[model samples]
Each structure stands twice: as structure tokens, then as C-alpha cells.
Target: MNFGDRVKEVHREILSTPHGDLPQEFVTEAVWRGEAAYFLGWAIQLFDKPHPSTFTDPGALTGVLQLLQPDANELVPSARLRAHPEIDDYSALCLLIRHLLQLQEMQAGGRDSLERAYQSRLAKLGLSPASNRLEPGAADAVISSTAKDSRGLYVVRSLAAEWLLGEEE
Candidate 1:
């Protein structure tokens, strides 16, 4: 069945239920959960089918990676790419689903690892972290020693996404 079909039915059921009349956090969570689940399920079923190998080429992936800036702030809280009980914008959801597909293929093909990608980036900037976690380098100080370059938010977003994705993998 379609996402609209499933969600509309939920809306109908919720409107009829006692919780439906009460606009509360639980209701919001319920609706978001349903939507997120629906989208993820749809994405899995749709992409799991056979497709051309052109989509999995390394050069194509590199191009895609080059253009993909962290978009953690683009989607609404519920509409993020996470598979949590929340809503996400259509664009954000689509990008996430597509990225998952690409990452899976890249792994299967034995291509460059995401860790390597991050490491190479830091190397270019002459910055390397000794640990897996990114220390803000503000230990024992009120101010962060590492200066912000306006993309600090993006780094936080990327790290969060990477953490979540790593858990899944």
C-alpha cells in the first residue's frame, strides 16, 4: 500500500481514537513514527530491486560525495533522515535513502572507507585527532582552542549521522 494510504488511515484512526482529540506529544510521536517507518519501508522495498550497475560505479560515488554537504539542518526535526519516530522533509528523506544505497554498494565493492574519507580531509587541513571522538580541544578551558569556521554545525551534524549510521552497520 502507498504511504498516503497508510498515513491517511492512521489519521482517520487517530481522529476517531481518544488520543486523536488530544494534540499531545504522544500523538505527534505516533504520527511521526508511522510516517518515518512508512518512508523507510518504501525506500527499502523500492531500492532492494535490481538496478543497473552504472549506479554503483566509484567515480559516480566520488562525484556524489563531492557535492554532498552535510544537510542535517535542512529537514525538520521529524523529517530528518533518521529512522526514528519523527517527521522528515521529502528531500532529506530521499537523500538519506539514496546515500544508504550508495554506501552499501561502495562497501560491497571494497572502495574507500568513510573513515578514510574523513581522515584524508583532516590531513589536508593539517589536523588529526588522536581518538575516534573529536575533542573540541577545550579541555580545562572555558573557550575552545579550535576556532569555528562556520561549519562547526555541519561537523556536529555529520558526526551524529555517522554515529547513527555506524550503529546500523
Candidate 2:
């Protein structure tokens, strides 16, 4: 299936279970996949900005559920999309989010892995530290944002600043 179809299918399965009673595993998976959805949502113009609160606030998560519903009429046609650039941005953001999350978990070698990924992805997009597209201490911001609230949304938000904000300009 195409990515749109897959997103719709996953949205169905995720929303099938009511919010309050969702298993922890299900919720964890949702947060991870939801990061992708946030990218798709931007590509399709369903979202103009990433809502970081979706990770911790039930009400915000409910709003995302509403927007991402399979039959939601928010998606634009694929013909209108600049697919390659969006894909590059998505990949870069994915790497950034993964690096930040690993750092938050105090994982060893996160910076080294991130540097490698930056060379491969962010460098091409002019987002490497040399280009100044990626702000300094972005990982620290995510870590601080989630210190009290260990939800994955802060990582999403940090990467959003790197990507979605650029889309606006």
C-alpha cells in the first residue's frame, strides 16, 4: 500500500481502542508512529505546526486523533506535494528525533551516531551545525522539556523546530 493508505490504516488501528484504556505498549507505539504522522500531516497540510502536548496531554492527543481519522478531509492531493524535499526533511527529522531521545535516555555514543547521520542527511539539507540550520543545543532543549514529563512529544517538538519551522519560510 502507499504511504497514505498505510497511515490511514495505522490511524484506524490506533483509534480503534479508546484513549483512556489504551495499553501502555499501544500508546508507546502510537507516540513513535505519531511522529511520522506529524510529518505526513505537514506534507498534506493537515497540520501547520506540530503539537508537542500530544505526548502528555490527553486533550491534545484527542485533537490529533480527530484530525488523523481515516476519513478526515484534511489531506491534499499527492500531485501537489513536493515529494522529494519532504522525504528528505522527514528523514532528517527522524534522525534528529532519534538522537535526542537516545541522549535523553543517557545512551552512550548517541552523539557519534548523530554525527554520522548528520553527515548523511542533515548535511545535504544544509542543516548541519556548519550551516546553522540546526540550532545549537537542540538535544538539550528536548531533554530539558521532557525531564519532568518523559513523554516523546518534546523530541517531536524539537525536530519540528528544525523542519516544520523551515517549511513556513
Reference-based lDDT, each prediction: 0.33, 0.52
- lDDT tens digits, residue span 16-92, model 2: 66666777767877765566556555555545545433443444544753554553444333324435555444444
Off by over 4 Å in 2: 1-11, 51-74, 78-114, 124-126, 129-131, 148-169
Best-fitting candidate, scored by lDDT: 2
- lDDT tens digits, residue span 26-100, model 1: 565444333333333323332221121111222322232221223422322333243322212222222233333
TM-score of structure candidate 2: 0.51
Best of the candidates, TM-score: 2
Q: Considering summed lDDT, which 10 consecutive residues are worst modelled in model 2?
A: 73-82
Stretches of model 1 off by over 4 angstroms after superposition: 1-19, 44-169
